[model samples]
Target: MAQPFSVDAVVWDMDGTLVDSEPLHERVFYATCRRHGVDLSDLDAGVFVGVHQYDVWNAVAHRFPPTVSREAWLADLDAEYVADQGSLTAMPDAQRIVSTLHAAGMKQACATNSAGVVVAANLMTLDILPFLQATVTLDDVKEGKPAPEPYARACTLLGVAPERAVAIEDSITGLMAARAAGLHTIGFASNHHIAAKPEFHVLADRVIHRLDEVLSLVTMPAAAR
Candidate 1:
């Protein structure tokens, strides 16, 4: 059995952890690349999973130069995501987990590397914004995932110390950010598109296959954590 731990606040990663948006992101990315006549046949699409769009674009541009400017490429991707907001559904039990924690009087927030525009579209489209007390996006931080600023910003916004908070994430970058920020980390590995790997298990305090498992982690009381 998993040991109980005190959890006063829950910070979530917006992409794969809360919303099933990676597939959409990947699709749009490839479509945009193709439009720019950039051939990514040899590139691993999985590399684009958890990082910021600009970082992804920068890496792509460095390897296979795109015809469009960074701003234009980003705008195109963002517009595509926003227009396809209907496909931005929540991960299984993600809504229940958020609502359950909220009902239990726990503070909650979303910390993401995504831009505010995309984050707003995803959360608002999925009706998750109301349940989140705060959201820290790349726009709100000088540095994003793998830098700890996003999660740190979120903890600050929630007025909760990082040690007392739990962060759920689905990507290596997100996990690194949460752990580096001093929050207990849970790796959500149920998404087959980004299945849990060795590094994920190593980084997370615990790994859960479903979002519903977060309920127990938050509700249970521990003698010591």
Candidate 2:
């Protein structure tokens, strides 16, 4: 059974949650690392999941020669990813869920660990800019996910309290951020993060494979009124 729907706002994670761009992102990461002569294994790729691109670059740079410039490497990686955004896709039922929520008068916002440019590109790609009431990026916060600042900032922007917001996330880091912000969370397991096990117990207050399941949680029950 699903939990009852009672939240006033929905806070979304843009990357893997709203768009099917994680795999493409991984490809770009591998390509960029190779171009810089860095060998990244699958596990190394996994470690970067849900982290901001600049942070990932800085971390990766630590494994390279001391003289290597992290800023230059990050710029190159950003260039590659920006050029590759054309291949991105909206996740299953993303548009449907978002549209339904918007029509229902529920507040909606995007809280992502991604850069502002990346978030803008994705919103443009998915044609969902008009539906989103607020957008928060890593640049807007002193700290990113797992720190709670992103989600907290998002709720503030949306004019909603943390307890009144529901967060939809696809990675453990994202789940932790939302949880830390005191919001109810739903975990989507379609991507690499939760593919191995139904780790709902670890990341989310609730878990569902399909986006439509969110409707049950966000919609008011007849008995409640």
- Model 1: residues >4 Å from true position, as ranges? 63-67, 220-225
Tens digits of per-residue lDDT, candidate 2, 70-144, equal: 767767766787898889999988998898888778789999998777777788777877888999988799999
Cα error of candidate 1 at position 27, Å? 0.7
Error of 2 at 63 (Å): 2.5
What TM-score, computed on C-alpha atoms, does each candidate reach?
A: 0.92, 0.91
Q: Give the TM-score of candidate 2.
A: 0.91
TM-score of candidate 1 to 2 decimals: 0.92
- In candidate 2, list every pair of residues with a backbone clash: none
Specify the highest-TM-score model's number.
Answer: 1
